[model samples]
Target: MLSTKVAADTTPSTRNYDDNVAVDTKKKVDRARGNITQRRCLIDNIWNAHVVDYAHVYEADGKKDGLISKLERSWNVKSGTLNSNTRRNIFRLSAKLHRLFDEEKWLLLPETKIVDQYYEHYREAGYADEFPVIKDLSFNYTLVAHPDMRQVAIHRRVEGVDINTPGAFKTFIYPFDTFPVIVSHVHPCFVICNSGQKLKDYDKIVAFRKGDTDQRKKRIARIQSFSKRLDGW
Candidate 1:
């Protein structure tokens, strides 16, 4: 009789409130599990939506090797091989091509397996490494009031560098036209634009461009010519 009573108590129709709660909890757990699986699938698709392999393209092209060799020669020209001005022109042209690739969004973020590889390449080898994935770059400048009556304080931080430092951090400030030279020290695959001008109210950066002195002069000339033409109209 005890065995029969135990079987009757174990049946669903004879269950208590605790048993109903347990069943509802199990259903919620199953739904949460399903949601997590679906989210992972969606994230995977987004992460790999635009994977580009630049090295593979360069390898597939038959003349890539010769072209790279020529550029390197131009970059490393000795005192007698090419005049200093000519060498500078070559360097500028090469830099312009790199800046164009970055500005035009030709390079896309690589896959996870190779992303670290490209980062290491850029960090160690500078701009001459395999083409790096380009992303928007910006700087942060913070201003705070000093305890003294007459003075204010300014602090600056570049986009990629670390924030934590023990002592006074030195920052290099250059004219807007020299921005490209400043960035070339970090990497050639970057361009400075005024996208943040309206957001930050950065008046000085209104005419900044990623080019050398000559390029900056040409840009100024074009702007002046346009202004004059408009006035004549």
Candidate 2:
């Protein structure tokens, strides 16, 4: 469905506290705690409600456009902000991920592959104040459904050209959030899929829980394993 043979194979995919003393100390604290609890519930309600809606849409129509629209709406992402073709490409990507989900072909991308080491280098060079620190940058996953080189070799034998060659395939990395309820944790993760169909798609590039710490470690391990084999190490 991705038009590109290789892409057809790959792609898919806080708290606080305080204490104090005062006149209405107990009452105020309780009220404040109540407000905080209510806010948390409200936030979860909004997010989970959309998750349910996404599942419903995917089930009812089995279409990615509907799901993508819901995701965009939840984030206040205006479809108008992107050109028609860019939007279409995103829709296609969402569709491809869903298909990969069905096929159980989602590949976990390792952070080492995309980690911006230079980001830290720059920060250490007295640029820390110049940029916002995004601690979650390392938590993002860049899942891809890429075929192995061996598979590509076979493909080359048949197609007479190696799709894996540089520039032969166009990779699209999307900062996709909310992958329905199936992907437990619902944390933000990147999705890398190629649609060799288009090379000019300007739609520029681009989760978990368990307190998010343990989840991240597990993902990193899995991705590292995949990366090893991918690199033929």
Q: Among these predicted structures, which one has the highest TM-score?
A: 2
TM-score of 1: 0.20
The whole-model lDDT of each prediction reads: 0.24, 0.25
Error of 2 at 107 (Å): 2.3
Clashes of 1: 0
lDDT of 2 by residue, 144-171 (tens): 3332211221100112335465634322
- lDDT of model 2 at position 33: 20
Clashes of each: 0, 5
Tens digits of per-residue lDDT for model 1 on 1-233?
00011011211123232322233332332243222221111111111112211111011012223333432342342222321111001111122222322232121111222334333543475433244443322111111111221221112233334546533333323222212112111111111111111112223223332222553434333333322322232
Candidate 2 runs further than 4 Å off: 1-62, 80-102, 109-233
Model 1: lDDT of residue 62? 29
RMSD of each: 26.4, 22.4
Model 2 has an lDDT value of 0.25
